[model samples]
Every structure is written in structure tokens, then in C-alpha cells.
Target: MNSAEKIIDRFGGQSALAGLIGKRQSTVGYWAKKGTVPVSWHGKLLEIAKNQAIDLQPVDFIPIDDEKNLLPAESSLPKATHWGELTIGEKEIPCYVLNTGDRVFSLKGVVVGLMGTDGGQLVEYLKVRALQPHLPSDLLPAENGEIPALFKFDTGGEGFTKYAVGIKIERFNELLRAYSSALLDHHLSAHDSTKIALTDRQLQIATTAVRFLQASSDVGLVALVDEATGYQYERAEDALRIKLKLYLEEDMRKWEKTFPDPLWNEFGRLTNWKGSVHHRPKYWGKLVMELIYGYLDADVAKWLKENAPKPIRGQSYHQWLSGQYGLKKLTEHIWMVIGMASACQTMPELRQRMAERYGRTQVQMTLYLPVQH
Candidate 1:
């Protein structure tokens, strides 16, 4: 019996094997006709077969071929020990993008989340048509004993060798962008369903979350921001001041000058205080709240310009702020945004790190002083 015969007999029939792979019997027969399993079904087929406790080998595809191609072979593929994920559409496809000196990876599982019947077809779609070269290279198979011995597709074959995948580090980002773009075209995306109200820094937080997913990096967004901002309140105030210049400078005149003064004053040029001369002694928290709200207004405006749908973007500040989910609510969300950003200065991973290090989930500053009125 031939390799096809062996597979069919082992699994009952071509129809049974095809059923196991969620493919038509004709597709299974085509594999038998070509005397080779298509690469797309390689991972899934192997996975399902293993789950059924069937140990498959490469010779099953090339039963008539000579013995030389059956042995373990060497190939220079990257050493990718770190596992990561690339989320597309709604599914998060697990992958690895590691760089060990010159080599990148052996990609057998990259297509697990893609829309291909095999890895070869998916590679063709990405590299040939999409013009994305950073995708895994079609290197010959690396045996289970090789340096990059991680080839999940090599099971057992009879040709010179099956081709494996390797991606260059330089092209990793490009690969992600292309893969993400393709996913967006094929499936509904988060961007399409949600409003974009995050400021650039806040957007950085989102992107950092995504980047963390991509490489499964050990660090968190808040930690990375802390390294950049030194976890200082003054730095956060300065950054928020820059944000205010973009969207809320004029509305800010409602508060008196020298009330708290400009949060950041880089220039020594004398600009007269232009705030209203209202005569009410105020609580310090009220003044801080006003600045926080103004900053949020600007931050939301910028986020809307880039992420929100057209009608929302066109609304004036009053109209936008007056909506059902207006200032009072936005104030809280925005507070979380800036507060989270500020907290990053001291707590990189924030809640998790805090919980672990200090044995706490919340913190507060309480001043105990006798008040004489």
C-alpha cells in the first residue's frame, strides 16, 4: 500500500481524514494524488491527529520516495524561545518573533489563526500578493534535532526536505502591520466599533498594551511610561500642560491667574494674567479639578479627531461635552487616564506590582491634623 493508502487505512478512509481536518474528501484525495499533504493543513492535521493519539510521520506523504530524504537534516533557522501573539479580527493568533543573532524563527504554527488550508498558501498570500517580505522565509525543514529543531511540520516526508519559515527581525514589525492589515480586511476590527478618545500618550498606553501582546514582553505599559517620566507628579503636570495648550487654553481663563499659575512656564516673557477677577476664596481641589477637566476636554478632542466617527468629531466642545455621557462622566474617565499615567511614574506595572510589593490593592494619603475654626 502507498503512503495515501497507509493514511486512509489508518484513519478509516479519505473521507474520515478529511472530516477530521474540516476539509472535503476531494481535498484529501488531492493530497493523495499529489503524494503530499498541503502545508496549510500540516499544523491542524498534526494537532488533531495527535489529539486522537495517532503518531504521524513524514514518510506517510512520500511512501515511494528514496530513504535519503527521511533522515534528520540541519538548517540554520532562528532561535525563538519567547512565545507571543498577533491578534487579528477577534482571535489572538499565538506566534513567536525572536531574534538570536542572524536567524529569526521556524514558523509551523503561524498559520494556525489565518484563513488558509495550509501554511504554504498562507505564505504565498502574505509574501507574494501582499508584498510583505518580513514574513517567515520558506527555508527547508529543520529536523527535530537541528539548532532550530522546532519544525512542527516535519512529521515524516520523502522529498529533499519540506520548507520551513524564518522571519528577519528587521521585518518583524512590517510583518505585524501587514498581518494586522489583512486581518482588518477579513474580520471586524476593534477600531471600527469603538470611539478613539485617548490622547497621544494615552494612545501610547493602548499601543504599549498591544506591543506587550505581540512579544509577550515582561514589562508593562505603566512601567515603560515610568522609565520615561520618572514617576513624578510634576512631570505629569507638565505633560498635561502641553496637552492643555492643544485644546483648552482659552476655556482656562475662567480661573484667575496666580490661582495655581501655569503648570509649566518655559518662557520668561511677561504675559499679563488674563483670568476673571472673581472674588471667591476657593478650595484647592476645585482649582485642580478645573485643570483636569480642561485637559480631558483637549485630550478627548484629539482622540476624536483621529478615532471617533465623523459626526462626533464635528461637534463643538459644548455639544460634545453636553451629550448624555458628558462632563461628569468624562471627568472620571479622564481622571483615571491621567492618574494612571502619573501612577506609572511610581508603579510601572501599577496594580499588579503594587499588590505584590506592598501587599495592597489601594493606597491613600491621609493628613491627621486638628482643625481650629
Candidate 2:
């Protein structure tokens, strides 16, 4: 194992280290890619290690730089001395984050620049409201000439140093956005939810799916299940979208109005088929979850064949289950089979895994299939 991996292992695993750094486990792995640690991250890792009772030093991560050519070209660039500047709408804000989730905005220089003329007055009002009278750590302390008074942020990273405070990776962009918005009105904006970055294909699939939702006054299980189907395969997003939309067209023909907020905004983000290396069809995937519940030639499929659906056009029960109904019935059977499977095991293992993955165990779970169509 490389030094980075070794450090991560000592903290239990990648996930533990990720939790400490307030980053995704995958993003943290990037720092340790190919058994090489990024020079920029060397100091950060050492500090984290020290906090965890593990001994690590700067030299343990990189060469001593006695000779210039020994290091890679990219490593020589000036490292980010602090948590770094965050860009929001072409405006850069100097900010600091602490392990305690406190964010200290550096209002020394840009106070007037960002807030216009009355920026200082607005900041003064926020100083008392977002006040942190007691200093939590030296990382983001209020310098004498700083803004009205330093305030603790609602969110931040898990480490802090004298010069800089670390901000959580997922929260960095959001903090910048909220801070900028707050300066305008002197009050924090609404919280921003983490959004998944989608590719072109995923965006198309989501966009097309929203149209179907928009066209329907009320939707059934099939329509909902169709949202995430066929996203498991690479390059199949558009094909699946086309097939599902055509199949559900007649069902959605009743209403031609646009989609509600949840369909367009919420489901659009959820249904993004971000099938890249960092993200895969692990969870929230109707097809993959179907397999986990034995939807493919297994108990759930057998149950679905025997119990769910009505025959159509003289086709076999299975053959009749096509398109939207097929997806809908498949989804219904998945939940039922999951319940039955858990019942048989007394399922200490499954229950524990469920609690770990989703905060709730089988006993605590409830299913509502929308009373069918």
C-alpha cells in the first residue's frame, strides 16, 4: 500500500478518512492514485494523522526536495496555502473552514468590493446574528482588523490549522453560494442540496422523463419505476428513455400540462444516469435493485409471474407483462420479495446491512405500492 492508503487504512478505511475530510471516499482516493500522493495534500494528511493518534510527517509523504528535478513538474506549483478561494458567479471569496464546522469569511479586503457601499454595515448586522464570541480554534480566528466580528458557520471541515481551516469538499461550493447571497440581504439563503453532476445522456433521459411526468395528472407505479430503468447499461440512457416514453405515452395522454416542481426539479436530479467510474448503478437503480430482490429468473420473478399482472392479447402471463406494466409489476414484486426474504433469514445480517446502508431495518420498514392502478 502507498503512504496515502496506509494512512487511510489506519483511520479504519477510505470511508472513515472520507468522513474525517468531509469528502466522498472516491474523491479522497484520487489523492492516493497509483500509489502516489499529491504534494499539495501531504501536509493535510499529516495533520489528520496526528489528530488520529497516528505518527506521520511531511517527509513520509514526499521526497525532501533537496534537488529540484527529483520532484514532478506539477508538484512545484505554489500549493494552496489556505483552504483556498471559492469562485461564485465570477466573484472569488477568501474563506476559512474549521473541523468544528465553523466557516470564517475573510472580510478584510473584499467587504466593500462584494457588498457595494453598505457592505460593511450589512456585515456588522450579521456579526451579532452569526456571532462566535468564543474562538473555537485558531484556524479561523477573527483578526483585529477583520470584519465586525467572526461568526461560526453552520458547516465546515474536520481539520483546522493556524493559517487555514479545511472546508468539507461537498460543502465548499454551497458555502460560497450562501455566503454571497447572504451579503446581499444580510441573511443566509436557503440550504442548497447536493446535486449529482450528470452527463449529456443522463440529462436527456431526465429531461424526457420529466415530460411524461408533466403530461400526467396522477401517475402509477409503472411510471415511477420507469424513471430509473435501463440506466444500468452504458450508452443505453437515450434508448431506454425512448422506449419508456413511447410505452407510457397513452397513459400520460390524459393531461398535457407541465410538470410540478418535484417532477422537474427533484426527480430530474435523482434520475440522472451518471454511470461513470465514480458513480454506478449501485443504489436507487430500479433494475439493479430488481436483481437484488430476485426480479430476474429468481424468486421475485417467479412471484411476479405467478401473482402480479393480468394477461393481455392471449399472451402468456410473462409475455403480457411488457413495457410500462412490466417495469411497474417488476418494481412491485421487488419490494414484496425483499420483505419475504428478510422474514426467512430472521435476517440479522440483512437487517444490519439495511441499517448501515439506509438507516432502517426490515422490521422498521413499510411499503406502500400506491394501491395499484
Best by lDDT: 1
- Each prediction's TM-score against the native? 0.29, 0.18
Candidate 2, residues 29-100: lDDT per residue as tens digits? 875674445443544676788887886543343212223333234333223322444322123335545444
> Least lDDT summed over 10 consecutive residues: which range in candidate 1?
264-273
Give the range of the ten consecutive residues with the poorest summed lDDT in model 2. 252-261
Put down candidate 1 lDDT per residue, 5-89, tens digits, no spaces. Answer: 6666667789899888777999889777766565434446556767888766533432243335433343443334443333322
The list of candidate 1 runs beyond 4 A from truth reads 1-16, 19-24, 33-47, 56-163, 176-373
**lDDT per prediction?**
0.40, 0.38
- TM-score for candidate 1, please give it: 0.29
TM-score for candidate 2, residues paired by index: 0.18
RMSD of each: 18.3, 21.1
